[model samples]
Target: MCYLYNVESQNTKGPGHSRSLEVPPVRVLLFILATFLGFVLLELWLYWQSKDKPLQLGLWDLIFWGLLIFWSVRVEVRLPLNAGMSQLFLFALALVVLTPPWVAPLAAFLAQWGGSAWYKEFFNRSQDGLATAIAALVWILAQENPLYLGRWDLSDGVGIAAAAFSFFAVNSSLVAFVIHLDSQTPLREIWRRNMGWVALSYILLSPLALLLARAYETPLLGGWGGWTVLFFLIPLYYSRFYWDEKVRLEEAFDTTLELLMNALEAKDPMTRLHSERVADIARDLARKVKDGDEAYAQAIYRAARLHDIGKIAIPEAVLLKPGTLTPEEFALIQSHTTKGAELLSPARKVAFDQLVYNVILHHHERWDGRGYPKRLAGHEIPEEARIVGLADAYEAMTAGRPYRKAKTPEEALREVQELSGHQFDPRLVEAFTELWEQNPIWRDRHAYLAAKEGSVSRSTSPQRSSASASPSPSEPGPRTSEE
Candidate 1:
């Protein structure tokens, strides 16, 4: 799908292009300013057109519906990365269907009266007003006077669906576009993680807006249409609670994984940021291998972060030893793969998918069946496991321990290339070689750390050296290159 952002590629040859999607702070601010001005112009034009036309809704009618929509916005549920969702769209769509074409944008603009940042509040107003205005136009083309309809037919249902899709398309694209510009995240990934699940609520819930409008147009139980709108709140409030529960569950799972990662970090100080680096590389590689499957790439990233979680159960003596391990000590190190899997088995039923268990258990397995607990060879090993294994090996080599000095990025890349088809998947090895040539921030440990800590200078060239080094025969660690 096409995204609403700019992507510039580096003038270099590689398996993937180096995309520069990051926008400057000043540019983002200017974009927000432009959006606000555009909204003002559109609202003014819409008002001017409607000034001479007779309006159907009275002042009290607009006030009543606007108040309901404002209250809906007040209870918006907060999401990650300073985003939020609410059922305000339900009332907004209903307003579009029930009122004149010009009324929807005005109600939407006035609903953004209170928020944290003045600029952000105004931007939200602009985007919402624009989306509603577009939806109102769609409704006008389909049904000239929806307020006067007696009974609905299939064509009327189609009209409502089309209008709902138009609103969501414009609204979601604008919000996702700003986030894409600011954070350099892929638009597909952002939508998958944040907006994909809520899409059904936006589209499938369109019919409810029709019900809301009908209830308002034809009062029941001898009550006013305003009273019927108030009663419609019961089901909408429950639906809002369902969304809240989903977000809460996701947050709880994230917190649990973080706690486990912290415990593992405490036991092995050498692996302080090792998992994070591996995860970053693994995610990029997975995206390339899977042909830009954002959801699968995200799963690979999460599983990579916890691939070595089993090491936490190992004794500190074995974990922190600075010398070569004895035969028995090495056996204990090998057991960490199974130990990690068993430790997280309970979570498998909760939030952990089968992919996570596979990574924890089989990342140590080799393509030639020469490594690890199961000795699974070739395609027998899960693809996720192979991807994480290669990433783990690369990170372990580059990140030095107390006994072994760290390999330079050039040395590590050479070693990885040399081991292809033996300890690593040859296909993945080629992918990684191409990725390294692109000079991503995660190519160097220091670069990755600098980027993580918010430093802008992260340029590094791939060092081309003829020196070839073999993988260490007995580096002896829980998650070393040799394994």
Candidate 2:
């Protein structure tokens, strides 16, 4: 296979023009033939590995291959065959000449469709494309340099440049074709996101090609390097894209939920900050009770935030009532829970939607089964709903409404504790009491203010002393019996 001995030595002195020895046409043909056979074998091995599941060749596949062949043919026809062209030209020409017309189309189709599908499932197309392009370029460059090619002959670098350029050009072009066939996502965006993987492909594969060229004492064609690069880079690119898309999707969902929350708050001004405050408190308590399970705590928080989402269906007049509600008005207010469940049920994709829906629908449920909508008792109520219930009561007591003064944090805690096992879960109440004890002074001040407003007077003693141990000025001097 060594043709170097037959070629005239450049150092030899000759009177006439030196004639270069040429390999027999048959030898060159055989070398070309063997390279393709090698490629076929490698492809067969790959096919076998993935053979259990047959690859689906669909309409998109046809389009992808068709575009690839068209471009590859165009590039082949356009290649300048001047002396400056590297040996890569000969190699590429031989391969193209040897390949059946149908092969290029098939390869093109597979590259395009397979690449696109892979990107959609697991990779960033642009990144993968970039890496592949870079790898192809480097491979082309290595092939053109006689020193690098191990042929001990100087050849122009044009072949390497052309090979690199054409390979990446074809790959990226195929990618674009696949993008067009896939979805409405802008091709440019897909390209941008996957470009890194493309660059990485080149970075990883070029060295392998160089090593193969050295080992075989021939150009690196029909080797495992290309397929290996694809196997590794494709999945890597896919994973990056998958993760990025997942995060973006999550953010979008979160933004939508926030918008919904805002709309709900807008509909009932009295509950403007109520849900948010309750969510914060519930999340805090859930963290304690759930043993630092952040996910569970988050679920509780979201449930609390959306606990009154059903109240959007309630009339504004009833929700913002400044005076005592009639029995009929109270009954109307009770309908918000079921309405909230109904509203959230349609938004099933929302994170923790079920938990939020349950909290919204059952936050009013008493531990004794006296709660509205569904009179679910004790453990029958979801834990998230239970947490939201405590948060709701705490926020209601500590925040002033039109008909009531804000209860002190301490008074709120006391009321919740009193209602444990009757209105609130006993375990939740214990957690609330622990939280309140951490800030006694703030709690007492709010309790005094709540008592002064006469909002909680029906529940708490009107003559109770202030935290200062002094009788409240607002206390009536004495109760007057009929004189």
Which is the leading candidate under lDDT?
1
lDDT of each residue in 1-483, candidate 1, tens digit only? 111122222222454533233224676668777777776776677677667766777889888889987887777766654467767677777887787677888788786555344445656777788777777778777775454346644556776788889888987788787776667677787788668878876788899888888899888856688788888899888887888798898899778878888888888766767888899999999999999888898899999989999898889897766666677877887889999999988877678989999999999888888778898999999999999999998887777664556778898898888778877899999999999999998888877877776663322211122222323333322334624
The window of 10 residues in a row where model 2 has the poorest summed lDDT is 77-86
Off by over 4 Å in 1: 1-25, 44-53, 144-153, 180-189, 454-482
Residue-level error in angstroms, candidate 1, position 320: 1.9
Using Cα atoms with residue i matched to residue i, what is each candidate's TM-score against the true structure?
0.86, 0.47
Decoy 1 TM-score against native: 0.86
Best-performing candidate as measured by TM-score: 1
